[model samples]
Target: MSAAFEIFLQGTPGLEEALAEEARATGFAKAEAVPGGATLQGQWTTVWRANLKLRGAGAVLARIGGFPASHLSQLDKRSRAFPWGDVLRPGVPVKVEMSTSAKSKIYHAGAAQERIERALSESFGATIDPEATVVLKTRIQRDYVQFSVDTSGESLHKRGHKPAVGKAPMRETLAALFLRQAGFTGEEPVLDPMCGSGTFLIEAGEMAAGLWPGRDRRFAFEDLATFKPDLYARIRSEAPQPRPLEELPGLFGSDRNAGAIEMAGRNAEAAGLGGAVTLAHRAVSDLERPAGPPGLVIVNPPYGARIGDRKQLFSLYGRLGAVLKERFGGWRAAIVTSDGGLARATGLPILPPGPPVAHGGLTVKLYQTAALR
Candidate 1:
């Protein structure tokens, strides 16, 4: 098995460069970000580190084995010619997925699957079931079939710690992306006054202390025969120790719902940032800016489409703006919403919203505002 691998990142605003930079920060060399993903050359341990350290990535795909075939007959012949014994054994079941963007005539996915199954079964007498231990993803982008294996079993957002969540919680990946966009580096205080489940705060804490996002999870590729556990172990051993907790600033979160504060506190503890994050059963109107320099206030309050009521959300946005304007002078703010009318309701002079992002299956825009004080 080769040490190098390709990683796929899912985000808006074309963050391939950011993803590649994050990988490099974690010791992955020769990182290159492509259109939808980043390519890095490293050992098997690098694969483990990629999943663990990079917060912006979605999944890590290992280039197991592949051969180019321009036509259906050639695809069958070339696929059968590869030696499956190195990666697949006789007993393991396998799953197959395909993507095509080519001029070749092998357009039918069912036909491609048939050819692959036949080649595997005929060559090795292996029982290739429709459902099995292995998942094979095939991409025929630009007339070239590139097959790879998925290393991450579940979505990397699981993080294995947030067992409970609050209403309209943000995805960890999205939170990280916003942090990067807002130029958050974990060096200053972070406040999420409308904090729900504390995803943003936890991500900030992890960023501050150099905690790997994937440390608690397992990848599907680990079960493959070609996986080298020792290499993964060596990589983990070489990772930098967690940052001293004392260096991290106080992270504060508040919500009107006492239950939400309780959930946020639990999640912070689960993330080992319990001491750094302070969750309170208070409303945003009551929040005071921290003593330090201007800090960040990010809110993903209920929007019209998200909450299914335009009037209610408009009132909520107005109240939210009143609170920020009265209390949080000198603080930078980022408000994410799917409706332009709600953003206008804030009364905070909205900078033209940045890239539209897909959140909760809704196309949302990020409206940035700054405190006059």
Candidate 2:
């Protein structure tokens, strides 16, 4: 645990590069984007810092140790021999989850998981609970078995601040990544005209104020054997103090539903952005440019896929586009939707869409526009 090991920052499937960029910006110098996440080398302290600071990572996984196991017996023997004491504390509840590939001789994931769970229970004197907060993820691929611990107990998107979520509300992780993808560096105003539960604007406010996303929450790493309370306390205390919200750029959101507006307001307040963010109960057609330099106008409007009629949405999108064209000149826009037809209805001179992002059982894409003229 003292030595540097691979730390995987699990990211949104299509937003791994954005997560990597964020990791590098946050001083993880060797962060590199891979298929599922970004990988970097770090010790236990790095894992703690990652859980505390990384906004885009869904979970922080520490790759503790692994070995090759071509057969079930080999897997059991190796699992028992793994230094679980160095990571898992005795009597602490743990869950073992496994995934296997066709190329691996240990193709039965359940069997592999049972073997590992038995090893933890019998060899390491650990408690195996299916409902445990701490998770030990095992992957068997191409005859290689890899063991990683999910240090972020819940998905990082939970953020633990927003208890009021609207229908099809965007995850905080996706919102942060989308904000980054839209070139938002927290230097200017951000308005989500269709803001549901205020995720985008609150995240923007938090970013601008230099608040750590995980400050208000606990991580699964704290339950691991390697966690050092004093070291983690130092790391928490070392984080930059939040800048006064008034000194930062404005963050605004509006929704046609009054309930949504109220929900966003409450969520913003919970995130310590109550005074910073402006939430209004208004329609997109009522959205007006704020009195300031142009910034990002990002929206995750309803698409026909899950909520509304497809034909009716075109008109809504068309109106939204017209409003932006007329009122939000010089502001860049990013629209997220599953339907290209709905996005095209905006007629905002969109650049090519980014890679598809999975959200709420739909494959959505971000259609961004250059600064609107």
Candidate 3:
């Protein structure tokens, strides 16, 4: 077995606890939530599994190795002496990124990055490309240097299966964490009346079918020297077969725009959920309770900062609240919005909102309610 190392799961800022919950539920060892993300101790296989299974992490980073460097010359000397060949293959293109703090003597991030890049190129014979697939992240804080590898190439939210997205579409990583926050266990139905591109519905349906989020995607870890094809293949095969769509709970979505509905259907089919998700081109005012036991009604509506006028959205929110209160008895609701006033306009018995989450340059919160009377 490979030696264990520190693995950091970068999470959505305000929803770190939710990500921590998911990490623990997924059986990661020593999973602890921190300010920006979660941490765990694991081996190379664990790193691969994290990239494959963790739905809430924006990126998975492996803390390879580092040493304290009080100055630029020391940083360059130690960096050249470090065994870069153990994890990084020679001749492969790579990128170096650095962050520094005032507590560190090496407070110049750009200069530090240059030293590390030169060391890799001259001493290790590695190609440094701005657009490289592999990224080496360095942090210099309190006079200590720490090195980590960005094992995930692109953001995990891409999911590789969703190529078409509507305006201001919710990220899959954030969507998954929000679902966990809403207490969704994949055992009940989920409806999204404002389902642009069907992100919420598709994520819910995928969970119900026991699908893995990274099953369709590739990661930068595969390009590392530590990657083993056979071991990774076995891990992939260990995933449970997807449950038949009929055996899973119903997943429904609706949008007032016909174009949005078409895009949603295409994305669902691409995700192997063609028959499992039901979508419609209908307004939120026309939404009706499905013929089944009560479940969750979750939506990510347009906010005034990004989409529409604040005053106009109040009536829209009011009508939505009225429809749910009058017809969807015993069901719960969760709304993701930037304006507390907009969420308040719904007039559902909302609990205190979750921590503010940064989304698309705006801070948003998740407002939820207990099952309606």
Candidate 4:
């Protein structure tokens, strides 16, 4: 084993446990949930699996090395002593992010950063850039420091497929995690009544088809000198491709904004899922169940934070409830919103609700209502 690894998952406040639960189910043994992250033990294969499978994880990191540092000089010396050649190449540009805790005497972050940067550059000629192809973060909490490299270059949520988006759009990773929470499999018809940019719908299609989330992109670690490219290639070659579109369930989505729907269609097509994703210009009020007896209906409507009014959202929720109860009674529904009061206004008798998940600095709840009468 190289070392005990840490996998960092980022999302709205309430979704940590949900994301942790999913990570555990996906062979990440001994998974422990923390605020904004989950640390688990696994090898490089686990790291690779995480980037490919995790829907809620915003970033996956591999712990390169670290040691305790009482002062700035100790921090610099310990950092320089790390085997940079083991993980980083000489030519690749890198970025450094540092955070200090109360126990550390290194009050000046810039000074601390400069020391580490100088150490790396002088020792290995490693370049640092914020927009670089690779990023390494040094976090000093209390007197201990942890050095980690971001294996997932962009946030895993990017998925590199969505070129266009709408206001207040839901992230692909969050949508995947929510779908799992709502018991969504790719085998059932899914309707996103207020689908913005079709993230949920596209993710649903990918999930049902067993499509690897990282299939369309390259990882930052691939460029590292010590990275086992052969091992990674073997892992990728052996991964099970999505069963077949015919065997998976169809996906459906709609939005009041025709532009969002158009963008969603284009994004889905770009992801090679145009045939699997069905998007249309439709309002939540007009949502209805097709011939399917019961499927999953997920809506991420505006929570009065941005385009919609807060008081007005109550009416919208009420109308949405009416539509769900009358038109899609048997289907399972999941609604994501920042407003708890507006969620209750839907009058759907949802359960106690899960913990708050963080989304763009806001605490959003994944509200679910099932067993509709």
Candidate 5:
């Protein structure tokens, strides 16, 4: 068993605490929200579980070892002495990346990367690849350097299931966090009226079914030397079967574009949620409250879109508010948009927007509304 180490869960700027809540809910040990991300101490298996169970983490890093080095030669010596065999393999290709602050003695990132590369090459017999599956990251702040391994090969948002995507697609990680922010657990139904590519519906459906987001993806940890095949096999095999679609609450989505509706279905099928989610082509004004009970309405609409005329969206927001007020009574709504003016245009009594989130070069905020009358 690998020793317990600090595992960092990278989250979106404004949504770090939400990811920490998810980590705590998923039973990660010592999960705490940090400035840029979340951190927890865990063994190797915990790393695997974080990749599998954490829906809100953008990336996961495993803290290796590092030392204080004032110069390149000292860095090389210390890095070579570091036990690369403990976590990383000898032959596995790696990419060394470093970020040095102005307060650090090693001011040149390139020079620091070169020293780390040489250490890996001489001691670990590892080849450096620009596009390697394993990433070795170094963070130098005020002469203190911490080395970490990117345990998530790609961003956690790239679940490797959805090939078809719509314009301004909401990342799966963001969608999951946003769902949590809206107070929707697996028990409640969810609807995304402007469900381009069905991100919200699919994420909700997976949550309701107890599906693992990382089940379909390969993690970088699989390439490490510390990986135990039998232990990992047991872990992977322990994946719980998803609840039958009929047993869960409704997870619905709709879009005006027929193409988006079709693509959404394909994405759902790829995610093993074809039966769990129901996406259709319909405008917001045509949305009907799903029968049985009121749930949550979550939508990510275009606010400062470049392709569409911005003026046309006001009428669209107005119609969305009108439909929800008249038909979707007793349901809560969460809207994400870059423009507060457009959010207010919805005419729903949405609460004041929260901390601005950096998304696609724009700062967006979530506007939450109480249950409609």
Candidate 6:
């Protein structure tokens, strides 16, 4: 339908720069970071490719249209006049959500939402549903009404293949970006000594084996009127064949809990990545570097707010640091923690902190290390 439009790739708060870099590296055109997300300038096909290829984006929004609304009456009139058939088909259900700024005359978000819904229903014969999979996001800022369609139904972190998870599993999108920040390039081994559900290990293995992150999922864009199913299939089919397990370097993980290790194994197997991602049940104290070229060791251990008590975690962090310092030479390390004191307890010469990333309401920072002395 439309030739070209602005594509918004939503990212975590502090990781917008990482998402922008990922967008550019993945061949997106004119990719740049914005406050809440990254923008890519491209056609309809590019939107589809972004949904399928970009690993760091939480959701992709195709900004369809916008207009300056002097008032509610003008907003309704202009919304009806817009060509809704180009993107939204008749009988397709859409849920409208609107946000208004303090400077706008039409200050009620509910009023704007209802007006747009009525226009889509009465004028375009489209169904309006509060529980629809297709979400129409609208923003009213400084009296300007901007509209965008949520091309991604669920967050990209789902990945569609991991049915099992340990407590507080790290999202795949965040894990991918964190791996990049740790300087991983699929050429080195990755070890998650305190791995829970084995997110970091599996994601690293998938990247190394050339597996596409979105192969197992369906996107909301497929339901759009402008969606070209055949073209989308072609884009998905362009992904490379996964490398054999033996050819991939070690992507290893181990947990103290047997149940966690089992669940992580099952999740990796479901993702068709069991061969490249190896999981075992063990404690952080017993962690030994895999026998090969040195690589990056990244882990997300429990913090004070969840899983373990604050006073008792100091020894756990201390043990993890001591083991790494004693056993792993020529290997780099990265630790993520919401508490700076916990990070310091690692005693591994933590590098300068990266920006604080929001993780489940807690702000966590990634502290990395150079090759061990």
lDDT of 5 by residue, 1-373 (tens): 6577899999999988888999999888479999778999988889888998899998899998778988778888898898889888878899988899999888899988998899889887999999999999899888878999999999999988998999888899999999998898899889999999989998999899999999888999999987888998898898888899899899889999999999999999999888878887888878988887889999998775633677988998899989998998899999998888888998999897777877887778889999999
How many clashes show up per model?
Answer: 3, 0, 0, 13, 0, 0
CA RMSD per model (angstroms): 2.6, 1.0, 0.8, 1.9, 1.3, 1.1
Badly placed stretches (over 4 Å) of model 5 are: 305-307
Candidate 2 has which clashing residue pairs, if any? Answer: none
What's the TM for model 1?
A: 0.89
Residue 303 error, candidate 2, Å = 0.8
- Pull out the clashing pairs in model 6: none
Q: Can you list the residue pairs that collide in candidate 3?
A: none
Cα lDDT tens digits, model 1, 61-111, are: 767657667678888887778777776655666777766664656777778
Best by lDDT: 3
Q: Supply the global lDDT for candidate 4.
A: 0.80
Name the runs in model 4 displaced over 4 angstroms: 1-12
Error of 2 at 321 (Å): 0.5
lDDT string, candidate 4, 36-100, tens digits: 77878777677887887777788888877788888888978877788898778888998998878
Model 3 C-alpha lDDT versus the unseen true structure: 0.93
Which sections of candidate 2 miss by over 4 Å? Answer: none
Q: Which candidate, 3 or 6, has the higher TM-score? A: 3
Candidate 6 lDDT: 0.89
**lDDT of candidate 2 over 26-81, digit per residue (tens):** 88989999988899999999999998898999999999889999999999999999
Which whole-number lDDT from 0 to 100 does residue 24 have in model 5? 96
What C-alpha lDDT does candidate 2 achieve relative to the native structure?
A: 0.92
